[model samples]
Target: MNDLALRGDNIVKRFGAVTALDGVSFTLGQGEILGILGDNGAGKSTLVKILTGFHQQTSGTLSVHGEETLLKSVDHARALGIECVYQDLALANSLSIYHNMFLNREIVRRGPARVFRLVDHKQMRERAAHLLEDIGVHVPSVDLPVERLSGGQRQAIAVARAVHSNAKILLLDEPLAAMGAREAALIIDLIMRLKEKGGLSIIMIMHNYAQTLDIADRIMLMQRGRVTYEQQSANTSVAELMDIVRREYRAMRATTAQ
Candidate 1:
C-alpha cells in the first residue's frame, strides 16, 4: 500500500438518473504507467475527471500516496503533487514558452505580496530553458511564442509544465489524439523517457489498445461503466484485446435484441 502512488476502490459516479462509473477499482504503483482503455460512453472521461479532482465520485474511495484523500478541487490535487494534461493542453498560444510554463504558478519577487507581486521573468526563463533541456524537449528559445511550436512540441510543453509543478501522479487525457505518426512518436518517446526516470506514476486514458499496450506497464479495459479486464501489458496482445471487445459488444447486442 505504501509503494502505491494512487488507488481507487469500488469507485462509482452518477449524474442523477445515469450511472457513469460502476464499481471501478485500480492501483497505480510508484513509477508505473497504467493505460486505461475504453470506447465512448464507457466512463473513461468521468474517471479521468474524478482522478484529476475536477469531479467527485458519488461513492467509493481514493488514496494518494497511500493516504485516503478527498480531492477538493483541481488546485487541491495539484497542491498534493497531482497534475493533469488534457487534449487541449490548456496553453496560451500568444504567450512565450516561459510564461506558459509558469502560468498561474509564476515566481514572484521576495519583497512584494498580493497585487503588488512582481513576476520574476528572468528566473522563469532560466528555469524553463533548463527544464525543457532536462526533459529532452527542444525549442529555439524560451522567449518564443507557443504558437510558433508544432503540435508535438505543444504537447511536450504541457507535459513539461506538469513535471515542473512536481507532479507525482500524472493524469494524461488522450495525449496523442489526432496526431500524425511522427507527432505521436514524439509524445511516445517522451513518455518512455519519463518512465525510465522512475519517480512519476501515470494513468493514460486512451482509445488505441496497441499504443497503450506499447507505452503502459499495465492495461485496464472499461465497458459500460465497469472495468471488464485488467492485465500486465507484457502478457497481453492487441489481438486479445480486440477479441475481447468484439465479444463484449456482441453480447450487448444480443441482450438488447432479446
Candidate 2:
C-alpha cells in the first residue's frame, strides 16, 4: 500500500458565483498528523468535504493510496480507508454502544441470503468492550446506549470505531471544539495513542494552535480559500504560527472593513 494516503492537487470548488476553495493542494503521509488552520470561511470545511468525497472538486485531482481516484461519496471515501470523525459525531443516541461502534458494518453470521442471517451481537459487544478498554475509555457498559454516555466517552467510542475500521487517513474537524479542558486532554491523548500505536495518519482541523502544535507533525494554514503557509512542527514555533494566523485574520478584516 502507498504510504501517501491522500494527495490533493490544485483543488478548486465553487458554490454558484462564490469560490469556496481555490487551488488548494496538499499531501498526507501515513501515520502523520497534519493540522489544517484557517479562520471561518477560509475553505477549511470545503477542502475537507472534497477530500472525504462529500463534494467533488471543480478542478484539479485527488488521490487515495497513491492512486488517482475520484471520491464520489462518503461511502467511496470509506472504501478507500479514509474515515472522517466530524466534530459533531453522528452516533445514534438510541443504539447500544456496540451498535453505535459497528453501525452499518455489523458482523453477521454467514447464510444463503438474509432469511436467517443473525447479527453477532455477543461478538460485537465483546469487541466493543475490548476496544473501549484498549483505548482506555471508561464507559459504564457496552449495553448502554450512547445517549447515556458522557461526552468524552461518546467521543472515545467514535474514535474507537475509527480504529476498528483500520482507517488509513483520518480527518478530524475541530475535535476539541466545545470540549472542556479535561475532555480535550483525553481526546488529544487518544489521538496521540492512535498515531503512536496504530500508525494512523490524521488531518486535524483545529483553531487551538497551541494544542495542534503539540500534536501535529506538520501544519498547513489556509487563507481566503488558499493555503498560505506550511511548516513542520519541529521547525515551527507556536508564536510563528500564531503570527501567521493573526496576519491572515487582520488581512481578512481589512478586506471586509472596506
Candidate 3:
C-alpha cells in the first residue's frame, strides 16, 4: 500500500470534564477517500477540529508524509499543505470570487520587476478561472461576487480554493448537510474528481451512508467519541452499515432504559 499522506495515531481531545475524543486514529492515503460516519456528539466534529489544527489534540501523534510534527494552529496545518473546507465554508459573501479565492495570500506587483507585494488580482483571477474549469465547475464567471453564484457554485468555489492551494490533505465537514440532492450530487462528483484527478487525500464526515458508500474507499464508524468499526466500501454494503448504526442506537437506548 502507498504511504499515507496524513495519519493520526491515538489522538485524544477533551472539553472540560467531557472527553470528546479518545484514542482515535486513522490514515488517509493520497487520491483516496475516507468517510467518517457518526451521530451527533460522536466526536466527528472534534476529530475534524483536531485534524485541521483548530483544536489541539490532548495527546497522540499526527504525522504528515511520515514526519511527526506538532501542528500548533490552522496556519501550521495549512503551511503543511493541509486545508479544511468546513461545513459553513467560511466564504466571504461580500467579496468577489477572485478576492475570496486569494483572500490571505494576495498577489502583489512591486513596481520595478513585477516583485510580488500587492494583491495580484490579474494573476489570481486567471488562476481562479483555470482552477474552476479544471475541476469541471460550470460557473458563469470568476469575477462575480460569490453572493451571485448558486449554492452549488459556491461549494465548487470553496473546493476549488482548497484544491488550488496544493493541499495534500483535505478535510470536509458535512459539505452536503444543507444542500439539495442535485447540488449535493454535484459536490459529490467534484469530490470524487478531486481524488481521481487532483490526487487529493480526503477525509469526509458524512451521515448519509449511501452517499458515503458511493464515493468513499473506506468507511469509519464513530460512536460516543470513539471509532468502533471500519470497513472497506467495496467489502461492505449500505444495509450492513445501517444495521450497525441501528444496532448501536438500540444498544444505547437499551442501556438508557434502565
Candidate 4:
C-alpha cells in the first residue's frame, strides 16, 4: 500500500479575473508535517480551502490514500478522514471543554433512552480528558468552559478534538500566530508528539520561518498563487527562504517603481 496521505497535482483556483492559485502541486507522506509559508495574499489560504473542500479547484487533481477523490464539502472531507483546524479555532466559547470536544458528534447512550438521543455527557467528558492527556495537553478541568482557557490551551483542545476524530490528514492554519513564546512552545511540543505517534499526516500553514523550520519535516513556499519553493526542512535554511522572499519583494518594488 502506498503511504501517501494526500496528494495535490497541478492545482489551480480562479475567481472571475483573479487567480488565487496557479498550478500548485505537492504530496504529503503519512506521519509527515509539511509547512506552507507565504506572504499575505499568496494563495496559501486558497489552497487550504480547496483541500478542505471549502472550495473546488478550477483545475488539478486530488488523491487521498493513493485513490483519486473529489472532496465535495467540509463534511465530506471529514468523512474522508481529513480535518482542518483553522486560525479561528472554531470553539463554542460558552461550552465546556468536553462539550466543545464532542460538538456536533455527541455520544448517545445505547438503550431505550437512545431514541431520545440523550447525550452521554459522562462518556464525552471522560473521553475528552483522556484525549487531552494523550496529546499531552494539561488542563485544569474538562468541565471548565473553553473561553476560560488561555489561547494556547484552547488551541490544544481544538487539536485534541481533531485527533479524537481519528483524522488521517490534518490541516492546520497558522497554529502559532499571535501566541506568546511559552504558548507557542506548548503547541510545538504537541506537534512533535503527534509526529512521533506516526500515522497522522499534517499540513501546517505558518508565517514564522523559525517555527516552521523547527516543526516541519518539509516546507513549501508560495507566492502570487504559485509554489515558489519546496524542499526538505533539514536541507534548507532560514536565510535561504528569506533570500527568496527578498528577491521577490525587490522584483515587485522594481516593477512598481516603473
Q: Which candidate should be chosen as best, given TM-score against the real structure?
A: 4
What are the per-residue Cα lDDT tens digits for candidate 4 across 1-258? 378998999999999999999899999999899999999999998888988899999999999899988888999989998999998999999999999999999999998979999999989999998888888899989999999999999999999888889898999999998999999999999999998988899999999998999999999999999999999999999999999999999999999999
Candidate order (lDDT): 4, 1, 2, 3
Residues 151-256 of candidate 3 have per-residue lDDT tens digits of 8778888988887898988899998888889999999989978877866889999989999999899999999888888999999988998899899999999999
User: Rank by TM-score, descending?
Assistant: 4, 1, 3, 2
Backbone N/Cα/C clashes per model: 0, 0, 5, 0
Location of the lowest summed lDDT over 10 successive residues in candidate 3: 109-118
lDDT of 2 by residue, 1-258 (tens): 478878889999999998999899999988789999888889998888888889999999988879998899998888888888887899999999999999988888666634576788888899989988887777889999899987877888888898789787888888888888898899999898888786678998988888988999999999889999998988988899888888877987899999
Work out how many backbone clashes candidate 2 has.
0
TM-score between model 2 and native: 0.93
lDDT of each: 0.92, 0.87, 0.87, 0.93
List residue ranges in candidate 2 displaced over 4 A.
111-114, 256-258
How far off is residue 140 in model 1, in Å? 1.3
Off by over 4 Å in 3: 110-117
Q: List, residue by residue over 1-258, the lDDT tens digit for candidate 1.
A: 899999999999999999999999999999999999988899988998898889999999999999999988998898889999997889999999999999999999676453578898888999999999998898999999999999989999999999889999999999999888799889999989888887899999887888999999999999999999999999999999999999999999999999
Candidate 1: misplaced stretches above 4 Å?
A: 112-115
